[model samples]
Target: MGEKHRSRWVETLVLLVRNPMAVASSLVLLVLVIVGVFGDVLAPYGYNEQFVGDQLESPSGSHWFGTDDFGRDVFSRVLLGAEVSLRVGAVAVGISLVAGVLIGLLAGYYGRWIDDALMRFMDMLFAFPALLMAIAVLAILGRGETNAMVAIGIVYTPIFARVTRASVLTVREEVFIRASRASGAGDFRIIFRHVLPNAAPPIIVQTTISLAFAILSEAALSFIGLGTQPPDPSWGRMLSEGRGFIEQAWWMALFPGLAIFVTVLAFNVLGDALRDVLDPRQRSALSGKGAAR
Candidate 1:
C-alpha cells in the first residue's frame, strides 16, 4: 500500500512537471516559503531599524527597494513581512481545514437531519460576504494579528465545509464506501478510512486555493488597521503607510503590492495545476483531445 501510494505521488509529480505553469508556480511558491522561513537572516537590516539620513530614499545600489517614510528599509520590512503573511495564511487555513473537514464528514456521512442542521449553519455563515464577515468578526474580537487570523479562519470555514461536503457526498456513494458498511465497518471507520481518502483530492486543491485567499484577506484586514499592529512589518500595513507617499516614493507601495500579487498568483496557479493533475476526468479529457487532434 505504501509503495502504491509512493508510485501514485511519483505519477502526480511527473504530470505536474510536464506543465510549465505548474513548474513555474511551484518554484515561485518554493522561493516564497524559503523567504518566509529565513526572512530574518535574509533581511539586510532590522525590519524596524531607521536610517536617519535615508528617509524616503528611492531605489539605488545601497537601498535595494528603497526606504519608507519612517526611514525604515522597505526591502527588509517586505522580507520580514513574508513571515507574517505566510503565518496568517497557514494558521487561518489550518483552523478552517480542521473544522471544515470534521463538519463536512459528519454532515455527509450522517445525511438527513444532521446534514440539514450543519449545512444550514454553514449557510448562515456563507450569507455574509467573506470580507464583510471577517470585518465584523474583527470588530467584535478587537484588533490584533491573532484576532485577524481567527476572523479570517472563521470567514473561510464555510467555504471549506461546502467543498468538503460536496466531495464527501460523491465519495460516500462509491462502491467501496457501501462495501465498508456491509463489512461491518463502524461509522467512524467508514467515514475516515473510505470516504475521506477518496474525497481528499478536491480538499487538497481547495486548501492551496484557500491559502491564497487567506493571505489576501489578512492583507485587506491589515490595510484597514484590523490586522498586524504597528512596529510589526506586514505587507498590507506597508501598503497602507505607503499610500500617502505614492506620488513621491512609489517603491513603498509597489514592492509590497508586487509581493502580494506574486504570492497570490503563484498559489492560484498551483491550485489550478493540482486540480488538473488530480482529476482523472480532466486528464482523460486532455488526452482524448490531444489524440483526436
Candidate 2:
C-alpha cells in the first residue's frame, strides 16, 4: 500500500513537472516558501526599524524596494509580510480542510436526511459572497489576525465541503467501497480507508486553489483594518498605507502588490496543473491517444 502510494505520487510529480508552467510555478512557490521561512534572516533590516533620515527613499543600491513613509524598510516589511500571508493561508486552509472533509465524508456516506441537513447548512453559508461573509464575520469577531484566520476559514469552508462531498459521492459508488461494506467494514473504516484515499485528489486540488483565495481574503481583510493590526507587516496593510503615497512613493505599494500577485498566481497555476495531472479523464485521454498512436 505504501509503495503504491509512493509510486502514484511519483507519477503525479512526473506529470506535473512535464508542464513548463507547472514547473515554473512550483519553483516560484518554492522560493516564496523559502523566503517565508527565512525572511528574518534574509531581510537586511528589521521589519519595523525606522531610518528617519532615509524616510521615503526610492529604490537604490542601499534600499532594494525603498523605504516607507514611516522610514521603515519596505523590502524587509515585504519579506516579513510573506511569513504572515503564508501563515494565514495555511492556518485558514487547515481549519477548512479538516472540517470540510469530515462534513463531506459523513454527508456523502450517509446520504438522505443527513446529507440534506448538512448540505443545507453549507448552502446557508454559500448564500453570502465569500468576501462579504468574511467581512461580516470579522465585524462580529472584532479585529485581529486570529479572527481574520477564523473568518477566512469559515468563508472557505463551504467551498471545500462542496468539493469534498462531490468527490466523496463519486468515490462512494466505486466497487471497492461496496466491497469494503460487504466485507463488514465499519463506517469509520470504510470512510477513511476506502472513501478518503480515492476522493483525495480533487480535494487536494481544491485545497491548493483555496490557499490562493485564503491569501487574497486575508489581504482584503487587512486592507480594511480587520486583520493583522499595526506594528505587524501585512501586504494588505502595506497597500493600505501606501495608498496615500502612491503619487510620490510607488514602491511602497508596488512591491507588496507584486508579492501578492506573484504568490497568488503561483498557487493558481500550481492548482490548475495539479487538476490536469490528477484528473482521471486527462490521464485516460492521454493514454488513449498513446495507444492509438
* TM-scores of all candidate predictions against the true structure: 0.96, 0.96
Candidate 1's residue-wise lDDT over 1-293, tens digit each? 45776777787787788789999999999999999999999999999999998899999887899999889999999999999999999999999999999999889888999999999999999999999999999889999999999999999898889988999988898887888889999998988777887789899999999999999999999999999999899999999999999999999999999999999999999999999988988876655655576
Give the distance in Å from residue 65's predicted Cα in candidate 1 to where it truly belongs: 0.6
The predictions' CA RMSDs to the true structure, in order, are 1.8, 1.7
282 Cα displacement, candidate 2 (Å): 1.2
What local lDDT score does residue 120 receive in model 1, on the 0 to 100 scale? 100
How high is the lDDT of residue 152 in model 2?
94
Residues 177-212, model 2: lDDT tens digits: 888889999999989887898899999999999999
Clashing pairs in 1: none
Q: Report lDDT (CA) for all predictions.
A: 0.92, 0.92
| Model 1 lowest lDDT segment of ten | 284-293
After best superposition, candidate 2 residue 252: deviation in angstroms?
0.5
